[model samples]
Target: MNAENDLIKLYSGRILSLAGDIPLTERLAEPQATVKKRSPLCGSTVTVDLVLEGGKIAAFGQDVKACALGQASAAILGAQVIGRTAEEITAARDQLKAMLTEDGPVPEAPFEGYEVLLPARGYKNRHASIMLALEATAEAMAQATG
Candidate 1:
């Protein structure tokens, strides 16, 4: 399949799976720590909320007003991060950066879901939206730990 088509599928899949219009729409949450990131190029914004327990993520959620790519990225991040440790989330963020920037090998298992975003690598403008969730999540973890 073509890159655009693949992106469309990934975007639609996540947007369709998105639950509860209020949180994502109204941007409401009481996160342990919140990190907000914006794609200056496109004006897309993604704010992530992380609740940590025992050095692991007890919950992961986000409020995003952006393109389909950003929404899907957030969904994938939320799904993989819950129950994972801060270290694990950091590793995933690095892996995601590598995948998008260096053509690195895709991470295994849960992160494999992010493979759909690989095509986003070629679209430089879309990179910010694609990485927004991960960056914010990593920052939130850092704030929680420190």
Candidate 2:
């Protein structure tokens, strides 16, 4: 198979669906903290706005401008970000990086949904876009708590 075929496999049906399923595409009215992450290579961007209560995320919003891979990552994060803490988001981000760069297993539980991205492992340029959402969320959580 050629590289184009490999890229096609990476954007499987499930991944495309997730990419289109981004849930929180609006900005928060009064977010406690907000962060925007960008991938210089792909020019993909994901902006996260959040409110934290009692050390956990209470409300969240996002504006995602990325390719299918990045959008899928944001979709997963949006689906599960509520009630999450900075620690959890950071852990997920680390796990994702390991998965893409180190032949690591899919991220543990809550993040196992990332298995859909397994095919993306061989494509290094796409990694930055795929990581934008989680990175921004973790940073926003820190700013909210800082």
Candidate 3:
């Protein structure tokens, strides 16, 4: 497909709509861990805060500063991140990375919503921005658990 086609698909209505409906848009009063990831390529960033209890996330919040693609990803993460384990978040992050760069299948449920971003597979430059939320999430999870 041409670049225009790629851009059109990448910015579909569903993604643009999802981008505006982000959840967990706050900072926890006292988080167990917090991580911020930046896409130097796009100057997009996502800061994730987590509070874990009983080996699962009990509370979550995020400060998302990114493009539509990144916001869409944060929306997905915000939807399912609570009550999930660090390992689960890490797996989803890995699956998303593979889906973008290695021709892997969509991530499993909860995070399955990431399918909206499949068209981004062809745009290498946008990959980092698209991944900001999950990267920050996974990193925050790791710090929270360890």
True-structure RMSD, every candidate: 3.6, 0.8, 1.1
TM-score of 3: 0.96
Query: Mind giving the per-residue lDDT tens digits that candidate 2 earns over 1-146?
Result: 69889888999999999998899888999999999899999899999999999999999999999999999999988888898888889999999999999998888878889999999999999999999999999999989999
Better of 1 and 3 by lDDT: 3
| Off by more than 4 A, model 2 | none
Where model 1 places Cα greater than 4 Å from the true spot, the runs are: 1-29
Q: Number of the top candidate by lDDT?
A: 2
**lDDT to native, each model:** 0.74, 0.93, 0.92
Better of 1 and 2 by lDDT: 2
RMSD of 1: 3.6
lDDT of 2: 0.93
Q: Give the TM-score (vs. native) of candidate 1.
A: 0.80
**Cα lDDT tens digits for candidate 1, 10-112:** 4554454542221333333677898899999999988887788899887766778777777777767766776887777778778888888899867566777
Which clashing pairs does model 2 show? Answer: none
* Model 1: pairs clashing at backbone N, Cα or C within 3 Å: none
Candidate 3 residues 29-102, lDDT tens each? 99999998999998999998889999899999999999999999999999999899978988999999999999
